[model samples]
Target: MLRLRKSILTVLLAVFTLLGCVAGPSLSAEKTALVVSVPMEGVVGVSLENYLDEAFAYAAEEKAALVVIGLDTPGGLVTSMRGMSQKILSASIPVAVWVGPPGARAASAGAFLVMAAHVAAMAPGTNIGAAHPVTASGQDVPDKELSRKITNDLAAQMRSLAEERGRNAEVAASMVLNSVSLTAREAMEIRVIDTVTPDLPSLLKWADGRKVRVGTVDVVLDLKRYEIRTFEMSPRLRALHFISRPDVAYLMLTLGILAIVFEVLTPGGFVMGTAGAVMALIGAYGLRMLPFNWAGIILLVAGIIVLVLDLVVGGIGVLSLFGLASLVVGSLVLFRAPGGELLNVSVGFMAGITLTLGAFFILAAGAVWRSTRNRVTSGQEGMVQGEGVVVEDLAPGGFVSCHGEVWKAVSEGGERISKGTRVRVVRTDGLLLHVRKVEGENLEEKGAGHK
Candidate 1:
């Protein structure tokens, strides 16, 4: 009986050991906190919108304890910003926007992103605000009533975001209403940001134990036990983001036009045409994310068309001058739309590209003009002015050897020609070559001048 009891105890101990071994890994896994870091830099356009959407989905799937957005942007499209704000507000996990690495800013639409985050932090030397609505060129809206409506709407939106985040709503609204700005420390003092942390590690530590609202429920962040896992934008998204810059898109559009023109001028291989189409599509996609002037686009197209026409019609530089002026003007106004206040086309860059394109257009036109006037060197036209040797004599018809080929011939004046006479080809009628007797030139001299 004692042995039976011992055996049962032994069996129970072994079973318990096996269960503990199996559960240990699972229990440790539960204690590991996951923090997802998403880098948000540059313009908040379609690339950012798509990147954030993917990041949020990934964070939710990983059950992240916190999502940190490392933000550094001048500003971007209002529509894209609104979309990003909606994602932040609707996220199941707490989202923190950190403007860090020093000297970074949350200006313009970036200020709204700061307001949208459950927790907003900025590094030393960083600044925030300047949420005023204006044209892409940073100019005030032209229409008084339209400007007033836009300002009021943006102010209300700013106020709502700050109020929701429990920050200084009045001051936040003033950013949009009066274009106010504040430093990192000033933002903290005025309750615009949660804290000022210099780096991500310090940010995580400062964020630890913070209670923030997630969806309808309030949740506390456990960042102390976190494993910082950075979620990067995919390669394709990174490329799209890179080209999303207004300048890059403008350059791409220019290249696309040039490449297509090249394909049109020399059209056997479709390589240039295909590449131009792709680049044009990409540039269009980038431009679509921003507010652009349709008139500017029309003018751009008109300028290019006129430049091409100059080449086709052999214009004497007048069309070229007008086209160049129109191109520069169009480029100046391309991104200067009502809501594109943050976008800027550098004057130097624009001038450089325009000058280069104008030079290319002029050079190509000159080449085309020269080609039109040059002598023909092949086929029927090549037979004219070519020196030949008459192999058969006749009153009006004979056979002649020209350019190493024999053909039926006739004298230009219908005069009789002796065999072995050196002659010059006047013209070709079908396979027949009209010949004229060469004067003061022997066969050796004529042969030497054949080409």
Candidate 2:
């Protein structure tokens, strides 16, 4: 009996050991390391700001040890860039800005963002810099005095960020003041960035033991054996991001205005009005977010207004031709980046849209307008003095024949008329007509009315 008990204990111990081996990783014995990657590409608009807010907050929510921002963008709005910088400056988790995948760049506002990160990294063949401040037309500060103010301000900002990160401040300032650019290797050699890592795994590997100061707290990155979770922009933000592009915003504005114009020219369309209003509002919001030339915007609006007015006041397409010219010219200079470069929307694109919209207003609108002006052939109301035969002998309220149909009619002058008396419709209140007998119109026995 004792031998049997020993054998059973041995069998139980072996079975338990096998189960433990299979379930060890799934158990809550060790801490779960978290890392999150956020895409920081394109024009840094309000949508990108909102996304960054959510992403940083999520890092805190998930207790993430590292937050990586994959960046590849041209410079964007200064307001949005400043907001992102502040968020990064105040974040609890260490944020690493990586300009990745050979040939990508973090220019202008992107350079500022990278400089602000705890770990500024880049991939080989990528570049950064060209931090100059220019107008939408690409001109630098207008005069020496203005240039001094702009340069000094940007230099001060770059200096502050570089000093905090312990990087080459003079180089960074020169980037803004002179619009200098550099490759990843050149940047690393000049101490602009910490390292040039080719991939995320390599970046994480190099960052494993690094120390970073975030919001007055010094922390070490614990990236070993951590799972990276990529947080993509939400659908709402994605759509907003898409619309925030200058070219897309311009297209939406044009299409929206044309749709609204179509509704006005051809009235009684609820669908067109509702859709046009919504799209126009969205496009306007996008333009407000972007760096647009307000003068061009005003000219565009004036062109549309003049076209509409000409249609209303009657013209031989003369004002329309002028308005078309204004629209085309306004569209050409609608927006240029501070670097003096227009968006990549082709001239052919604008020409096609302008021609199509113009044709609709000129041809379709003209046809519809002409059709409405022909004649009023059929009606029940406003038939006063219209010749009609009294179908029933009228005392006060009786049926009268008019417009090939009998109407419940009352005598306008309250005169008693015989059944054969010819009558005229005075007016109509609902289905009842107020009519009176026509004078000298009862010539033929029963059929003769006014000729």
Question: What are the TM-scores, per candidate, against the unseen true structure?
Answer: 0.78, 0.67
Cα lDDT tens digits for candidate 1, 1-451? 9999999999999999999999999687558688899988888788899999999999989888889999999888888888899999998889999997798988899999999999999999999998888776567777889889988988998999999999999999999899999999999999988999999889989988889998889997776577989999999999888878888888888778767876887789999999988888878887876778888788777788778788878765678878888888888788877557544446678678889878877887788777778898878898999998888884789898998988899998889977778899988898989889987655554676895
State the weakest 10-residue window (summed lDDT) of model 2. 337-346
Report the lDDT of model 2 for residue 144. Answer: 73
As a whole number from 0 to 100, the lDDT of residue 45 in candidate 1 is 84
Q: List per-prediction Cα lDDT, in the order shown.
A: 0.86, 0.79
lDDT for 398 in candidate 2 is 89
For candidate 1, the 10 contiguous residues with the lowest summed lDDT are 338-347
Q: Which residue pairs in candidate 2 collide?
A: 138-340, 384-425
